[model samples]
Target: MLKKLVLIGGGHSHALVLRLFGNKPLSGVRLALITPDIYTPYSGMLPGHIAGFYSYSQCDIDLQSLSNFAHAQLCLDHVIGLDLKNRKVLCANQPTVDFDILSINISSTPTKLSVPGAVEYTIAAKPVAQFLEHWYQLQENAVRNPQKALNIAIVGGGDVELALSILAGVRKLEIYLFQSSKELMPSHHQSVRRIMRDILSNQDVKLHLGERVCEVVKLINKGLTIKCESGLMVTCDQVFWVTHASAGSWLKAAGIGTDDQGFILVNDNLQSVTHPHIFAAGDIAKMINYQLPKAGVFAVHKGNPLYENLRSMILGESLKPYKPQTAYFSLIVTGDGRVLANRAILPLPSHQLWWCWKDCIDRNFMAQSPHQ
Candidate 1:
């Protein structure tokens, strides 16, 4: 019988895996893809998409056509639970899927903070599809009430800097950004963070540094407010939540070895430490041996090795390990057509030229994707 290979999630890594599988066939193996979304949004261009630089379709990679090329079954359903013993994947809207080898590339969840009234008050800036839908509606409302003062609060660090710029620039709204740390983008170079901090300050963004949000509550008057541990309280028309990035709770609940944040624990080979037959990639996974940031670039890097290892496992061959590079070139696209390129040691100016380069890189990535 042909070995069953089931891929979960249509994330950046899995897109490349499917493309590679489509480019080359593995005999005696049947492939299947289970994802809730038919189109996977490329995180690289997501900022551009939000800034009105790229259309939605331009940034979203079509999985349907790619699956067809790979001769893989595309089950458009959300994987709610996993059955490790039976080697089955439970879906929300479809029948159970059986697999011999399973690879998960599901992107991480936006946040796990269970702040009171968050569900009713705040909008998640992740699970991209939902964010798009909510943002579009909010944008429309903002347009309709152009005279109304639009006050918004974003709960996150420098990761939300791009979104903050867009919200301030595009809508000309009063934006408040709250971070738990004294400095933003602590993982990044000081110059990069300094530049962004300066930009936000000059652009009239209210930066609440070192203030951690404790509780979110809807006011009786008309708006929502969040109280910080530092005793700062602000009422806003909308609260955009981008603070944390955790993994699917199902992985940890199913007894898979995971980090404290619920990201699947895997070796350098991308194979689960506890279950060798299962592999994980993208933001949903944590390399036990290395500290890899949850970046889309890493997900893009893991694709080739993940594909090769999956193929090798079926043939009973030795699996190759993937050691991620410590630092990567990061280009932050400021909403107003400026790009900040971080090369660790280089103190480069944020320029439109960099924006051109970033656009070319992003457009090229989308152009090379599997499409019919």
Candidate 2:
């Protein structure tokens, strides 16, 4: 009997695994993929897509086509639960699948905060598909009401929030970026953070730093109003929340060893501590040996390592450790065909040429995928 290899989610890591498995098939292994969407969106190209630099087709990885090439079964459904004891994965619209080995590359979802009305009114920017749809509607509304001044609030302190702001620059919309921290891009170095702040300042984007959002309430005349902990109420046409990326609720319920934030705890081999037969990658896996930022780049890099480990497990070979580099280059698009490259402390100015370079890189990644 062929050993069943089940992969949950069509994320970047899993996509690479499929490609690798396609090129180098493992004996007696039957591959399967479960995901809600056929096409997985690339986060790296999302900013460019939002900024009108690339089309939707240019950034999506087609899972159905990739699965065909890899000789894997594609289950187009959402994984609602996992039966770890039985080594079975429960789907929303499909029958449960039993697996000999399992891997997960599902991305994180925006965590619900203590703030009131945030869950009901604010739009989350993690589930890229839903966010993209909402953003498109907002763009359409703005185009129809070109004369009216629009007020948009992006609640986050990460690079994603900045990217959204840059993308929203297509319209003459009045954008406000609210960060609870004293500075933006809190994870970045001071110099890089300063440069980002300067970029936002130059763009005339309003910044409300050091003010935590306590609640969000929809006003009859003023769309959505966010009440800050500092006793300030901010009214905006729409609210975009890019804060807090948490793992799928199913992971916790499945009794997987997870952190407080719900990210699955995985060893260097990317296998769950409690369930060695089960593997995890992308934003869902927390590196046990090395701590790394939840960047798409890391997820992309994990593809090869995961592929090797999965093959090793099938062949009774020893697994290899996935050591992440301390620092990686970060390119920030400022929404005007300009990008900033942050290698270390200070970010180097990357003009149109850099944007073009980034565009080429993203396009190539999408093109290499079988789905594309």
Clashes of each: 0, 0
Model 1 segments beyond 4 Å from truth?
Answer: none
Candidate 2, residue 73: how far the Cα is off, in Å: 0.9
Where is model 2 more than 4 Å wrong at Cα?
A: 160-169
Q: Look at candidate 1 and give me any clashing residue pairs.
A: none
What TM-score, over all chains together, does every model reach?
A: 0.96, 0.96
Backbone clashes in model 2, listed as residue pairs: none
Error of 2 at 21 (Å): 1.2
Displacement of residue 22 (Cα, Å) in model 2 is: 1.3
Candidate 1 contains a number of clashing pairs equal to 0
C-alpha lDDT of all candidate models, in order: 0.85, 0.84
Residue-level lDDT for 286 in candidate 2: 95
